[model samples]
Target: MTTTPEGTPTTARHRAPGAEDALPVPAAAGSVAEWTERYAHAVMDTFGPPQRVLVRGEGVYVWDADGTRYLDLLGGIAVNSLGHAHPTLTAAVSAQLGTLGHVSNFFASPAQIALAERLVALADAPEGSRVFLANSGTEANEAALKLTRRHSGGARPRVLALEGAFHGRSLGALSLTHKAAYREPFEPLPGGVEFLPFGDTDALRAAFAEGGDLVAALFVEPIQGEAGVRSLPPGYLALARELTTAHGALLVLDEVQTGMGRTGRWFAHQHPHLGGGVRPDVVTVAKGLGGGFPVGGLIAYGPDVAALLGRGQHGTTFGGNPVASAAALATVGVVERDGLLAHVTALGERLRERLRSTGNPLVREVRGEGLLIAVELTVPVAARVAADALAAGIIVNPCTPTTLRLAPPYVLTDEQAQPFVDLVAALRADLAAEETP
Candidate 1:
């Protein structure tokens, strides 16, 4: 067991023994090698091999089974809003579970209703806005897809998605995704989905100009997370809203990666500095919604859009479980009470400034708003940089061969963040030397 900052004890979870682990538990139960070998046989080969056996996490740091601690800059791909083992989050989950845990869709819990209200308010959506709970980001997008199709009224069936966009892995969400590798395996996906050049206003205008009437909705990520944290060009979102509205197409903003303060705003599209002032018909969010508690949501605005999906249209058994809802409620409460949105905004600016100030030869560019950032490398050695970063006790993700993504938890301190810039500078020098003749 590990103790949280509030002195609460958290049970460290370990994988139960499969038939293969019958040999015997190692004296060091946290040994990475022993656990890695067991994982290879029991788990599917989808994610290749496990990166490391993480035993415990507190704040912005996690300890591997080997007892080596690393600053978790990725934050579970932008899911841990409050960092790990937060007392507020823990207390909320515990108290809710003790009172009422899981409830069927037929029944409703206070947390379920309360969380929906909170999200609707946070969005500052128009009156009559509604929310649909789900288990993950993919499910949230899946529900949004169905709602969009229903709102299409059968006359408009074509949907527009940005190139390199990753909505989710479900059939409906995948249809909106543009990655060929993810979509190729599931051939002949749902038809009428069109791909547009990301950040290209002309392409967006042209697509709608050519097939405005046939288009049902246009899905966009305010900041493309998987596409290397690429933010849409200035006024791009506004233009999208104008074009979609003129064409009678609904603007569905996918905030799965940029929502819940990831971009220092409740929703990136709502950030005025990032080109807010535009309202979307549908917005899908997850990742940081439950603060690592595994919850997703679809927030629809306006009465017409909200009523698109009536009763019996769609639902989920574990969508609004009391435990998950309570977790989300507490997550939002803490973010608001602690003023984390403003904190994130300030911290993100400092991080970006420090990185750019390094003037490291290897770092080409650093881009992103708030905490959702990407450091573009001068050479395609991001994978190597990431590996070296791990060795140096810092965690980050190589989103592509040339792009390094950082989405550390909201609780990351300036002291912790400052050193990361220095680490990268040192790592870059090493990498540059290796490439030199």
Candidate 2:
């Protein structure tokens, strides 16, 4: 361990390796093919086959077992805020663990307290807003679900969520999540959850008007991540706020994929079109919050809403662990120090514009804001496009059969991002040819 000029302890071992770490060729057992084969037997088949077996990374590029480097546009599904092996994130986690790592919920650490304060400040939350830390986006939504029910003060309280929302996979969160394939097998989930058409002002008004009295809360994603980066229609969030408030139902914004500067703002709900005229009663965040360190949080605004959960009502064993808190704090600090929000805003526009400019026949449309983007293909060949991009040393996500999503690291430069656009444009014919009749 060594100290940098600013006195933060730096673990030199965590730094990206030099030529010494590279192998002439991947070891037989360590190769992607070999590891992938073994993974089938050892690991569950939840996320399907592994895409690639990555060995090491630096900045926005990661090297695979075969020493092939790739520009990671997905950023671990929008979780890597500072990109791979960020010095600040590594230093903060290493320093905090060296000082004080894990502590039970019975105790409190400075890192935990500081992170809570930082999140509250970033949200520009109400004066008495409170924070509840969890380990993942699903866990955060689980906490929020419980809080809403606890405050419902009735035997049965109905909760509403958007049709295209992806809250999490846990049973509680799954109940709020709206996907037939992901939800059908997990039937008999927590009850009283209903789905409403996303971004439909008329439907929102109708739902509330019909059953406002039975509703306890409404959960929505400012920008639908899993649904191919579908953003709420203009003025829709404001409408949601108006209806939820009028019906006395709490409005919850799920920022798991859009928060932490992924959308050029601290929270996507904070965008001018959404945050200016409306205020969410609760906000659930994770993903980039810890910059790949694994942390989630729920911010409840207003005194009444904050007071809903009493001490024994809800808790987590490892929720505000010191190491995770330190990582999140460092991630946010670096985002501000580097002015990444503005960078994302500018770079996002350039990337979107370039993708649209290609004017390729296979391209349908480009959507989303900031670094979170989605390119809809005229044919249902997005999966093929992603596979092609991967073979070409670029990593993008096929969020749907026809939608290719891009949530690159904020640290991704103009040079790095431009190649992705070019690669995708070149892959148009290859992608179209892969389409099944």
Candidate 3:
């Protein structure tokens, strides 16, 4: 037994060669209450209290500090593309870190270059398309924001975003987000950002109709995740594309939560119902890009757009690092090698159909493409239902007051997903029984 400098007793599981007191872990590591108290003291209270002190995870199952297991349906809010501790992702990240982990922005690594090329090819980007690597969805949006600013040689200063849009939390990205609660606190954001009604083709046309040349970019999410996984209506995206092209304003699709096969397509915008035949000038991607690893980037399509942000204009220290790139590459490799795209499509449709087949009055509708789904409730009991679902050992997200969002891992089995369907049906039965009384 040894004591940390702060006097917490610890026992070393393994001491590395020539390392002094390394990994002198606290003996009472499994006590959830103790860990939660420590977390309140040590971590910022940004996201309120911790839900559960999860310790270990494998596949779609995670165990809390109390040894209770949970079926992860949220997939870390759609980041765990291949689920937890995937062998391929682990091997790739470990191999890369052991080889060449990081370098300054002035230098480039083989893994970074390879991943960029792979993304460009997978996106079907034309000749001279380029990618600006970043560390998260926010950073990727920041890069895209800068690209929009550099458009029209600064003559067009106005940018358009959508209602219920969640671009990111940073100052620049914050300007484009729609929720007033998120924006009011961070007021005096970057100017000239106007939020239009979501998926309203007429509103989009009217915005472009007035001072169309003043608009530099039109930002949108093919499927709005934080806004309850709402997809754009038919012809809405096509109308956005036509207007932006006619007015010379760049169409920026924020695919942070909807890209990298989350919607069964390589990107959500490629789906016919969402954004078919729409060629966006800028595309931002993150979330599932590196499975559970933190990595994100923006793709600038065509040589004209790619040529914008040249030397000394933008850069990052950890972005495009070899280790993160290797993780993402391995994620893509696994998705391709295992044909998870088709799997996700079929599984997602089956799950949605199963929910609908339950004929539960509590369930208003089931929507979204691929594994990214939402079960809309007829009543505003999403939070209560989500808590109940958690108690039943399945994890889900109350994305909105009336919607339960389910962005489970693509590796989730049909059997693993049945519990949620059963939960909905039981809730309906409970409601009926109460009404009879």
Candidate 4:
């Protein structure tokens, strides 16, 4: 048994045989229609109608309530780094939970401390680097925003983000987001944030020049996942770093969707040809960190930035949780031990090569690094293609009217990727015929 933060004793979850059998089953759990109906009444409608009621997953495939298996090309929007039911991740999470699942900020756990150390080392952060764990991508960005404010005690007020960037939906993270629809709804947001044109070097330089000393920080997604896997222009990140350093502003890289080996590197920013060889003062990441177990973090590069937050200025009850930390540690371990990063690099290259070889007119371009790919279409038929893909036992995301984003699991095998590649080869041909007559 374990106790709540308030010391209320509670029964600990078990992994013993038949333990899952004790789980309470929803009356509508057996069917997609029934579950969707129940979800409509009980859950928030934030994501719109249910696409399919996914029941379980394994390796790179997921099953719906109707027992239909799908080749999950999106990997739960890039969160499932290790794919589903990974034994290492499951064992780590299970063991940690059975021992110590959570605790208040007042206390500490071995898992939390070890995970922080690992992140700092992986980042190649200089001495005095520190890590702040959060529960989600938005929370990680929020913490980073606060850290920047503490830089020079709010003297620098201007913050920079790029157009077409999607940081998160939280008010603080949303302020850095570029989509008008996602931002305008919340009229009153924290101020001093400006959205720059994506990869416009002149605009970036102008922002630094205009903002001058008031530039507190600039947040960038090394590869803008929500903007159809758009990668920054070559040297863009290095230039941002130079300017931010010269202007005395923080250069923050948001790696939420591209970190945890999603791009065949530990972090997307490490990819020199694409993400640039720049070094950021602070880095925020989440998505694939916990391999779908909900964990995020902010890494302060050195002592000066690390000391900005100080103590009592920030706190979270569930951040740095033992189970989450364990999950992350396990995810990283498997990626290393299984040499999945190399697999990701080679497999992504193969898939892109195959797609580009098709010479399909609808395949306007294929961009992005490693497994995070985008097939930009010549027409606004991405939604139609995605629907077709769903019907064909594959799962993908139409990130835009003409962009299909694929961020498959790092463990995706060549055999598993062939179906999606074949679908792309023929999809546009079929659509082309439709528009012809």
> Where is model 4 more than 4 Å wrong at Cα?
1-21, 24-29, 428-437
**TM-score for each prediction?**
0.92, 0.93, 0.92, 0.93
Tens-digit lDDT string for candidate 2 (216-320):
998999999999999888798888888877878888899999998999989998888766657789999999999999999999997789999888988999898
The models' CA-based lDDT, in order, is 0.87, 0.86, 0.87, 0.87
lDDT of 4 at 224: 94
For candidate 2, give the lDDT: 0.86
Q: Mind giving the per-residue lDDT tens digits that candidate 4 earns over 91-146?
A: 78878877887787888999999999999988889999999999999999999999
Distance (Å) between predicted and true CA of 11, model 4?
29
Model 3 whole-model lDDT (C-alpha atoms): 0.87
By lDDT, the better pick of 1 and 2 is 1
Q: Which stretches of candidate 1 lie over 4 Å from their true place?
A: 1-28, 429-437
| Deviation (Å) of 1 in candidate 2 | 25
Q: How close is each model in CA RMSD to the real structure?
A: 4.7, 4.6, 7.1, 6.7
* Residue-level error in angstroms, candidate 3, position 162: 0.7
Q: Is candidate 3 or candidate 4 better by TM-score?
A: 4
Per-residue CA lDDT of model 3 for 33-121, tens digit only, reads 77788889999999977888888777787888888899899999999988887767877887777678889778999989999999898
Consecutive 10-residue window with the lowest summed lDDT within model 2: 8-17
TM-score of 2: 0.93
Candidate maximizing TM-score: 4
Number of residue pairs clashing in candidate 3, backbone atoms closer than 3 angstroms, sequence gap of 3 or more or interchain: 0
Give the per-residue lDDT digits (tens) of candidate 1, residues 363-432.
Answer: 8899999899999988888888888888889899999889999999887777777667987677545675
